[model samples]
Target chain A: MTDKIPVTVLTGYLGAGKTTLLNRILSEPHGKKYAVIVNEFGEIGIDNELIVGADEEVFEMNNGCICCTVRGDLIRIIDGLMRRKGKFDAIIVETTGLADPAPVAQTFFVDEAVGRRTRLDAVVAVADAKWLKDRLKDAPEAKNQIAFADVILVNKTDLVTPEELREIEMRVRAINPYARLHRTQRCSVPLGDVLARNAFDLERILDLEPAFLGSDGGAHHPDHGRDGAHAHHHDGMAHYHDEEIQSVSLRTEEPLDPDKFFPWVQDLVAKDGPSILRCKGILAFQGDPQRFVFQGIHMILDGDHQRPWREDEKRESRIVFIGRNLPEENIRRGFAACQV
Target chain B: MTDADTASLTERTRAIVPGGLVAAVHFLKDTAAFVLGEAALLLAAPNREQRRVAIHDGGILAAACDGQRLVTGGDDGKVMATDAGADSTIVAVDPKRRWIDQVAIGSGAVAWSAGRQVFVKTAKSEERTTDVPSSAGGLAFAPKGFRLAIAHYNGATLWFPNAAAAPERLEWKGSHLAVTFSPDGKFLVTAMQEPMLHGWRLADAKHMRMAGYAAKVRSLDWTADGDWLATGGSNQLILWPFAGKDGPLGKMPRMLAPAQGLAVEVACHPRQPVVAVGFADGLVLLVRLDDGAEIVARRPGAAPVSALAWNATGSLLAFGTEDGEAGIVDLG
Candidate 1:
């Protein structure tokens, strides 16, 4: 699996320093070669031979299913890049300011040739720290860039005051509490923080828990903490309720019935996959001794038995969803029905 | 042939290491031309003499051979034609340095795509350009006409380079990748983005949906008589019959040579009904269409077999793998 090339997707609103981050990655002295696929070519001044332009063409698969859509241009570009396999160490795809991240993420899942030759490292979103609070209110694409990201860079923090920065962080957290956030000026975060993150790998499901358990005080008594009932206290600030998008975290000590859980989750995603952008879970089955790690992009779910549960580890099931207008009550009751 | 006579014929072939991923192999006369994923093409002669010829400044993206010269398009924005004598010449270059996405060789013309536009250059006339609605996913020239088929999202456009009429559009709902016409010029088939092959009967504009593939159908070839269209996408060799007027519209495809690995490439014999099947696990088998008798040409210990081809006379077979391992088998 290590032989597969790692691809990092960079997204942001216009004037959010995406090109700055790309140029930085290209000009860094890391001694690693990168093939950059950018929608806008002349914006990147780097003279790298591996830099290729993309058209950002998205098309539907499985007979016009919206959730099954993928980037047709990515499927073609990756296939072309694989011909020069040894020329580059990793690939970075920079999307347009108005581009949706769903088609880019789903391209890795839907295309067999792309999935086999390369692994999606992570989705890195660069946000203008001063203007993000306003963009989130007006641009739906800006909110998605934050919610679908695995790592986010709040760039241009020098222009915003400390209090304004705190407000921006709170608003981002209210929408997506899962992504690893970093504050940077001119998008100057460490190169390691954004690249080579195996965010989509099934084995990396272990990292999802810390993102959920770290901030919310509800992690200690998660059973009493029903879905959509986060206390939303961050640095003693009141919960900023962004009504359109939110993250729901569910946990239970009871082992789930695999037969019941599979059908319920499948049906739920089928009905609400458009609203549910991303969902991941590390499940504990009733009779199986192995832990099942599953992750989804829209309606597509990929799950497998990771390893045998260690005796020292607690056999708990935790599921998290970052979506818009999720059926909170129905999801909570359906998950309860899966508990044995 | 008896089962014992055809089994385990791995020693009947001569191995040649090309040392780069072989995207395709085409037989020019008696020489096996192995098109590498990078800049060169390996030409192996019948006497086992191999020569490497550089055809592109960078990676070769698309290639097509018309029994004389191999025409290839590359990331260097140049289209080149190389012959069996190791001689190469630039055919065309994109002024904007766009990656040449697809290429097709017509009777006397060479066609290639850069972004959404396709350029066709004939032997006697200058190049003509036409822009499609989307990026051209695949390009194929009709067997008997000067027309070219450009496969893209929503459908394929059939264009005649000399005609003044608006190009014909065959509307299908999904993105179409590789495309080819039957040898008899009756049907046009396209490998879609989905795991299926969609075809249109040219006479009546009828649609034929060939589904039930586990993966996208990347490689397909018509038999010598155009009786069957062999495809790669499943663990078994799938052949959709096109002998009837309706094509494989209501018929079931004949599946053969079930294996542990998915078949990734298929090359039909030019003079016989046998097919050379290449699998993802680096296995190559020559299976007869009559009874599905299999002859193991290469064993499974390397990368997927990405390319396979037979000489015009069907006396020699050449196969190449993704790991750059190549071999030529003599069956005369």
Candidate 2:
């Protein structure tokens, strides 16, 4: 897998310092040449060579927010880059602030030509500490980016008060507590933290955010008081913005029945894939010694059993679903049906 | 195309390297094998003995065969020459480290392009650089002459190695890529960005459109007699006949050996009616252009087979999969 070129997807809202991050990577003297791909509207401010501009494709999906739609031409640009194969060591994709991360990430999984040659290193979302509150309320794209990132950068920390910065961090965590949160000014963060994070690997569980994994780690719950509702008032979540997008983490002490869980999840995604931005689960099945871990972008789901459960580890199921107006009640009921 | 053949292929085909994306396959001599991928090069003797070398630290961008030696360019801005005896040398390296995008070797000379300038390194001179109108999209040397063709945004331009005269420009709209001159030097075809092929008759500059491909044509191979141009992009090999004056004009191309994956590489037999096609699924098929009859060579698994080549005598067929699986098949 290391032989495959690693692609770091940089996503953030408008004026969220995406270009600052891009320029940072370009000038880092890391010796790894990068082919920077910028959206037509989101051209990075850097003047270095090998910058490609791709068309922004945010259209209507009929059932979801108009701002939420798939982008195209990512496969074409990367394939074209492959022609100059040995010249560059990696690829960095900078998307328009209005674009959703699902289509961008899906290109790595869905396209055979691109998927075989390169792997998605990680989706790094830059958040504006000063503007995230308003952006999340008005833009579905802003919310989606936060939900899909494996790493989140709270940029422009200098522009916000300490309490305000804390609120923005909690709000981002509310959307995707699984993503590692970093505070920075002018998108300044160590380059090592952003690149080569094999976030998509099935077995390499990067426990960057232990807070989201809960206190019990497994088998029990440290903070399930919200019943997987993710409504954490106990952790300084000051609900300043009434954003429709929320994170719902469901947990159960009972082992699940695969026959019941698979079909239910499949049907739900089929009916509301766009509405369900990102869904991942660490499931324990009755009579099955292996843990079933699955994650998906919209309708595309990929999962496999990792190593066998250790004797000292806990046996339980935890699922986190992040999206707009998720059916929390139905999900809770559906998971209960899988209990053995 | 059949289950029995697929079953037999999986058992007979041996993987040369344990793992890596096999970028290309070239015959160093009659039996010497060269596979380029992930900046690594593997040379295999006719007896199936192998040696692996890291040619470039980056992806090998372009490759061409020169007698028993192969010249390859990479993103590292280095152009290298490798032969069957394992003699490898850095013939040229761009000072600025721009990606060497295209390369061609023939007539005892090698040509490479970085950005908009084309560089030719011959015996008499270290290298001479000539700037093109646009960033070069493709480069090729005339099979029978010293003229080199460079394709770019507007059209294809022809340059002579020893001449100071202005290049002969072949004009058309849109970007041109993967340029190829018919073996007879009577035609030049460029794969266009619009998933079609645009060609010039070279005699009267008549335009020929080879359209209707499902994707952009990437690989093109002229038959031994220059009668057909076997191409990839379609699920099957689309053989466009060029024996006529118009060159595949007002005629339907023959499609053969349809598969589940796209044909990523195509190699026409040097002396026969057969062609070898490598697909995205890592399957290689030897298909007869006459009837589309297929012989499965490699089963679908591994990475895509990015390159395919036959020896001068057309007896040995060599292939490399993206996952570093490579070997030579004795078809003689």
Candidate 3:
């Protein structure tokens, strides 16, 4: 077994100082080689010349988001880099401003060859303390980016006063309390602060997630006792629109039959392909403790088995979707239909 | 009539719909519009007074009008079914596979192909099973019949509704993207994504190669007369006069303003020489072949127009978009 190389994903709203933070990390003399990927090396005719040692290891997809069109290119590049083994100590993926990170994280889990070599260290998002407050008011993508982040850096601190920064930080925390917060100018934070920060603590996340991550760190919930009428509280974090997009997470203790799961997923895509942006899950199949990872964009889906369940870990399944005006009750019923 | 006379007549009938609402009949039950992004589908009744019998989700990958029930296959690897007056139901789902690229239903049997595998289910059984090779991309049901013709990744295959008989395969070398059978089932036309169109004599397996577009051929339809083939891609529609004498005549299918965006779906007027083209930029163009005139050009919504279909009478046109919007245009 190869040692899992930690991967950190950097995301932010457009012009939120993500590239600035990446530049700071590259300049530091941490003695660890970092492979960085971005949407474009040169935008508006301005080249990315600030990052140190980016010439050899840096790659620009230029094809749009790292999730959809350029995924194949991403897999090939990461696979080749891994083959070199000693060339880079870690990988940092900088997503496009409007990208959804679920698909990027899913790439690491769904691909067998890639999963063995890389581990998802954390998802770090940079926010323009001033712009984020307004952007999240109407943009579903912006809110979703904040909600899914494991760590958030409130950048452009110089533009806002300490009190304003604190307010923004509080707002972010309200939406996602799990993420660690930091304030910086031009995303100029220390590399140590961002690197090796494992934010996806299974136990902690499971505790916060009552429906999926039980207190036991298992994905199952023994309490069917709760009424099926459990309403999801947006908690003032999510903005509702008649055509708004919603992200929902579902977990199951029962193993899914691949036959049933496969068709159920297909039907959802067919029925609502335009509204669905991303769908991902770690499934536990009957008699198999090994994790089955599934990820999709619109209608395109790719799935495979990752490592077998660790002897110390419990087997359970969890799935999440980020989409526009998703009928939560209908989706839940559809998932319920998938139950054996 | 000779081929020229037929072309002239079709050009004349193209003015009937001349844009605007070609048909509109509200459903007794409320039905939501579901957009498949690149395509869209809706489940609604054809009339406000009929029993809920079918759902229709217009998808470019596959579109099925089964009695009053309409089923659509989306690029997202899903098959949705709905009775005319009821909400949509996901009859089959495969999120882990490639798009449900094409769908066809007939003789109470429905078959769809996604990322190479073809799945079929009949009204007699509630369960659907994979029944074809994985390389299949396009599929069609023999008109008013139980047999199915599937355009595989490399070729095409004809299958019986019952599993008792083995499928007959027709080998080809190209990536077949679309397939349609002639009205009499005597000929099968396959369109390649490479922009090449071919006609095959199903009885003897003879093939004829024809001219196609410069880019991927996204939508294709055959006129009821079987004398014209309407193909569109790269925002332009081409009317192939299959039976014309004008130097193997193939002219741009007349439409309201050259199709302005990516043409995603196209349907021929069931009984006329007219054709309807739906675009990725949400524009719908009704074209007449007689003088190559565009009769209608309208943007129904902000999303891309993904699917298009003409009802039984060829009077009502239904279209769906990526933004979950569906509209009915009345040609009457």
Candidate 4:
């Protein structure tokens, strides 16, 4: 896979200054050539000469919900890009506001050719903080764009008060507690946070969620009802939060049986994969020093045993599920029953 | 979803209309044909105008035909064969499930490469396996029928299965993806990881670097006379002349049939000076190499045309696109 190119999917809500961020990524001092793919050639024209206009054709799943669906044009476009293997260093795909990252991420895993030639680096999301919570309540697509992100850039922070900013960050954490969050203005964040993150890599998954497997071993409860408290808080203010999409973190200080863990996770994802946007857990398998790191998007799970736990690191198992209306009790019981 | 847009297709073939992504098309025999891709190897009869799906397992990625039998390698790890009759049988399977990336059928033997191992099965069904230095990037059977050349990282090996000697390796600096010996067996060329192609004279093993392509040379074809090797890389067909012993050395290549889009696939007629090129913009053109004259055979579409092939008699032309839309353009 080293020979394969890395593709970074740039997604954001409409008017979140994605074009400016794309322009910054293109004209940066870094001498890397990127093939920029945009949803459409809109008024904010991508100044890159090697821009490809992508069609937002989302293929729905058999379950009939608007979950993970493959983007046909992306496969075609990426395959065409593979023909010129050495032409560019990386690929940056800009999805439309209505786009779901599930299908975009699935294209890299589902298509044999694309999966073999290119790896999805990370999904960087830019959200307009001033109006993001509003969009979250009114638009399911906005929530998807947030939950599906590997990195969340809460842009337009200047437009909101510090308390409002904190509320947005809290809301973002509520939907996706596992993703890397950043606050910026004019969509300006350190370029390193957006590129070559290897966020989905086995080694980096732990790094992405440093608190995965309770690395800090902090006193955390399974039912962290932080979102419910902030779900609709009005200090004579107009900040209302939606609770349909919230994050549920399950942490246990126990070794788990692989046989029980895999199937339970599989069954849970199978029955609720559409509802579960992202699920990741670093498990301490019975008698195995190495941590088993796995993450899933819908039903597609990619995992393997990673490096042995550091001498000083705790061996607790932490599982994070970010989705809509998840069954926390059954999930907690199921995970707890797997303890050896 | 509206559809994958198998592109606004207007069929010109006898009857078969392949839908999905057409990975390749090859003339199976005199009247039968193999339209590769979502169909795997759909057996097509021109006279009877019947299309039957032959290999039904998975999408076919690599395929080659040897006049009578067609061999295909699929992502399913199965090496299969089918003749004009309709039945397709799996010749072999790699238990490890690696993609059988390259397949070649020539001179009574079928050879396929899965990862670093190359397997050859004779018409009598005798099979032999040889491990190359690395995963085989490309495979081609020598016209003389005694040797098979497997291109890999750092070099191309000319494997003489019957001989006791070690396979001759023409060492190069980079990874070689596509390997082929000239029709006369005097020269062997490889498409490298770089956009250039490196070739060597089989007699002396002299280096001949064919460079300056804007992209890696993926599609290659030799004219019927074996004097020119036409390729797809840039917007035009780059033809390297091999008329003299020097073989495209100290000589500029002949360029023909310039198009607005880059050429992705090219096919040379068996008996004529005509070459058909499929472009990235879905345009297909039949060009007369002698005069650089061209006829717009197929117009541009949503998906790029991926494969182009001509019958041995040079009477039938077949083309397939990435969207699984495939048909034949008859040129009597």
Candidate 5:
């Protein structure tokens, strides 16, 4: 698994500095060669020889599941890139402005050949700080990109006032509170913040728990105070006020029953998969010493037994779901019923 | 039975190091043309003569052969053909430098795909092109006519290059790859993005779903009589019976040569009921369909075998691996 190539997906709204970020990644003296797959080939002046073009052909599976869609072009391009395995160190895929990042992220989990040779490192989304508040009203794709991202860049901060920047951050935090947010001008942030983030790997699931809990447990919640109220007001805006997209995190000190947890989560995902974009969990099953780590993109779920519990670590179960119009009460109730 | 009962042909094999991973291997009479993953083709003759020919500017993406010439599509946006004498020709190059994703060879014509468009060129005719709903995943020429079958996202499309009629679409609601027409031209089969094979009976467009594969089917071939379609995706060699008019609709597939590793490539003998099965653990076997007898043509020690082919006379079998190990075995 260590030898598998890491793939970073770059997404944003139009003119959100995606090309500028890509050009910066290629022009930097990192000394690591990357094979970049972009929607338009000749627009960016990238110096890499492995730059390829993609048509973003999203394909649905025949199983009658609506949420089980994948990027067919990524499968083909990755297969082609694997032929020259030693020629490049990693891969970066630049999606168009109007594209959804779910299908791109699901391609790694759905295809056998692509999953065997490469792993999804992260989904980095760039947002125009000046225009994000306005675009969030009319563009649902922009919100989907923010909701599906692991790292987000509020680029073009130079064009906006500090109050407007604060408002943009509040809006982004309302939609997705768990992502690592950065303020940048022309996407001039460090490259380390956007690349090689094994955000989807099972082994790295709990390593980012500090930020996850920090967002959900403290400042971003509705009950928490000023920043929280601002976030709530931001969620009350035109597009997502009644049934908005948000992240819900559940935690319990008691161990969970394997029999009850498995059936409930599977049934939940099967029933509500189209509304759910991403879900992940780390469980402490009754009578099991191992930590069970799992992640899901829509209806497809993958889980495995990680290492055993350490004596110093607390035995807690935690799970997070990011999606549109999620049933928080039912999810909380269903999760509470799985506990012993 | 046991390993002791299986006959051994390991001693009769001659090895050839192609210097790169082999994408495919095609037999031109008595010679084996190994298409490397890079930009070269290594030709090895029966009398120990070997030569390397540079064909593409970048990695080769897809390859197909017509027993006399080999046609290849590369990431360099070029489609090229090489004959048995090591002579190469540039068939076509994409104007926008889009990668040629698939290639298929017919009687006197050639077909290749770039993105959602498929281009075909026949002798004494201009180049004709058509667009599919999505990227062309696979392409195949019909055995009996001037027709071509292209597999894409929703299903496969059947086209007649010479006819002015609309191209026919066989819908199955999934991504289809690696399409082929039965030797008798009675049925069309496509290996889907899922780990299964979907077929359509041309007489009536009836759907035949062949499921239960462990991985996505990558290699499929027809038997000598075209009665069986052997596929690779599981631990055993799976052959679906295509002899009856119903075409494996109600019957189960015959499984042979079960190994510990997954079968990744398969090639059937031209004149016999024999199949060369290559496994992910680098094991190659020849299985006879009559009684399920097995012969160990190559042992499991190197990388997975990615390409396999049999000569027209079935006297020689060629195999190549992902790590560039290749060899030819003389059955005679």
Candidate 6:
């Protein structure tokens, strides 16, 4: 099988210099023809005008992002681009500011056709240093965006002082320590710093955002204990008023029924609604050692099985939830109940 | 009711349309069914009413309701017509070099525009097609028999469907977003990608321009009486009265703010002259064309509304969102 094309999702709060970063990447001397999927082709009209490439070579999805609703369009576009093969170097999807990145990432996992062609590189989030500090407090999109980033670009350093930038960087690291942090003005950074890195270390994610990694012995899991402590400290931050954005991870050695898993997730989303921003996991079923990846955003849920586990790898199901004031015990119990 | 309760009720109403995927739901006269692009169209109506229609060769780009028939344009570059109620027979299939962008139907003819080409099928037997190098942007049917207006990337063209005469070109250079003819067909309004909205007299082609929107005008709708035109852009809606000196009557008033949501689609009431605005954040608000007072505000979650159309009676409003979900709300 041919190697899957790595899809790097670029997400940030509105006007956080995502387009500026994209323009910088396009203008780089590297002969990489990127297939960019943006919400609106016209909104980035000035950036499009500046990019030096034939219109056909630079593909734009136009209408919307690649989420639950437009995943078909994303798949179709990826399939079409793959047929032309040697035309582009990589696919960079720039999601709308308010979009939850989980659904977009789930596309690469769920569709066999998509999986054969595209693998997720990383979710790069560009955060506004000046406003993000306060936005992380109440804005669910901001918190979720930051929580999902594998590389967090704390952009707009010129807007803040050294001390303020350090504070923002600390906050981002606190929320997501696994993400490589960078501070820049107008998202100006070395392309190598953000690109070509496979930042999705599932094991590291289990350590960093442990709010989603739950355990019965709350004191046993170091990551869980650290997250709980951070949750308390984050409450003191004043900006995060309600803990609207929290991460919790659930792991189980028992096998789970895939059929029951779907409805349980649907119920969880139905009850939580908008507060449930992102949920992703790799499940190890009883009979099948192969991993089952599950992901959902808001009301959209999609999951599928991956390659069988290696002979030496441990078999365990790990699921994480990044959302607002999520009830960890209740979620843990829900997962425990799903075990077959 | 408390505000939270009201908000929850609105959300529940919005949730009637399933989230996460863009699956096409076709409401036939007798059955309501859902169709996934990958799977064959399924009809889940009571009494086992299901039939698969071979309409698309690749995937459907756009499908519109033409009277009682469904007209579809696909990536296959073929425009096919099928009965809306049942898969009885293929009405007509036209092959072309590129995908059909837009289609409009009138008295006895169906007109469609595909990249650089416009074709009109009249009387099911007579077909007239024209090859224009300029790509068409929007297609609209005029009130007169066999009359159609095709908005190209550069300008607009007036054509007779039967090919009785050569098409007349109304030359104005800009990317036109929409071209709408008045109810009486006396005036043609074209909203371009630029800030200017042009109004032209069909008889002499005398035009007037209105400017207020800071961004490209995405949607435009004429009042039922043909006395007012509602143009929306950058989250603001402007009502222009076609009364005074052929130009905009005066300063354009801002009906809604950006905070309310960016207006993406608008539909005028079939009779009462009230306008419905669908916002990018899924807030649907109704405004009176005369005074611009909001009649109703409905927030349908965060899915950007794609299209809005008022039913024939004007009492029911159907709006489609970017998520491929459509909602029918009762006004009365």
The DockQ values of the predictions, listed in order, are 0.74, 0.08, 0.01, 0.02, 0.77, 0.02
Clashing pairs in 1: none
Per-residue lDDT of candidate 5, residues A170-252 (tens digit): 77876776677778898987788889888888998875575466325223433221122333344444332213778788999
Q: lDDT tens digits, residues A234-275, model 2?
A: 543444323566666788879898999999898888776767
Model 1 chain B weakest 10-residue run by lDDT:
B1-10
Error of 3 at A86 (Å): 37
lDDT of each: 0.88, 0.77, 0.60, 0.76, 0.89, 0.62
Q: Could you give candidate 6's per-residue lDDT for residues A300-330 as a string of tens digits?
A: 5656665778888777788767666777778
What does candidate 3's lDDT look like per residue over B1-332, in tens digits? 24454344334332121121111121212332232322333334334222322232222245565445556665345787655445567768775534455667777777776544677788785544445443455788888567788875457888775666678888765556578877667777787634567667776777666654555565678877877777766557766555543312244433333655767678888788788887767777777766666655444457566567777667666666544455666566
What ordering of candidates by lDDT runs from best to worst?
Answer: 5, 1, 2, 4, 6, 3
lDDT of 3 by residue, A1-340 (tens): 2367788988899899887787777766677777776665543232322111111111212212233222333443464344234456788888888876666765565444466568777788889988988887866667777766766787787898755655565556445433456677777766776888754433223332343332221112221111232222324533232235455567787777887888988878767755666566778877776677765555556667766878876677787665667777887888877777
**Model 4 bad stretches (over 4 Å):** A1-340, B1-16, B32-34
Best by TM-score: 1
Worst 10-residue lDDT window for candidate 4 chain B reads B1-10
- TM-score per candidate: 0.96, 0.61, 0.42, 0.54, 0.95, 0.47
True contacts kept of each: 0.64, 0.06, 0.00, 0.00, 0.75, 0.00
Better of 3 and 4 by TM-score: 4
Candidate that beats the other on lDDT, 2 or 6, i.e. the better one: 2
lDDT of 3: 0.60
Native contacts retained by model 4, as a fraction?
Answer: 0.00
- Which sections of candidate 5 miss by over 4 Å? A214-243, B1-8
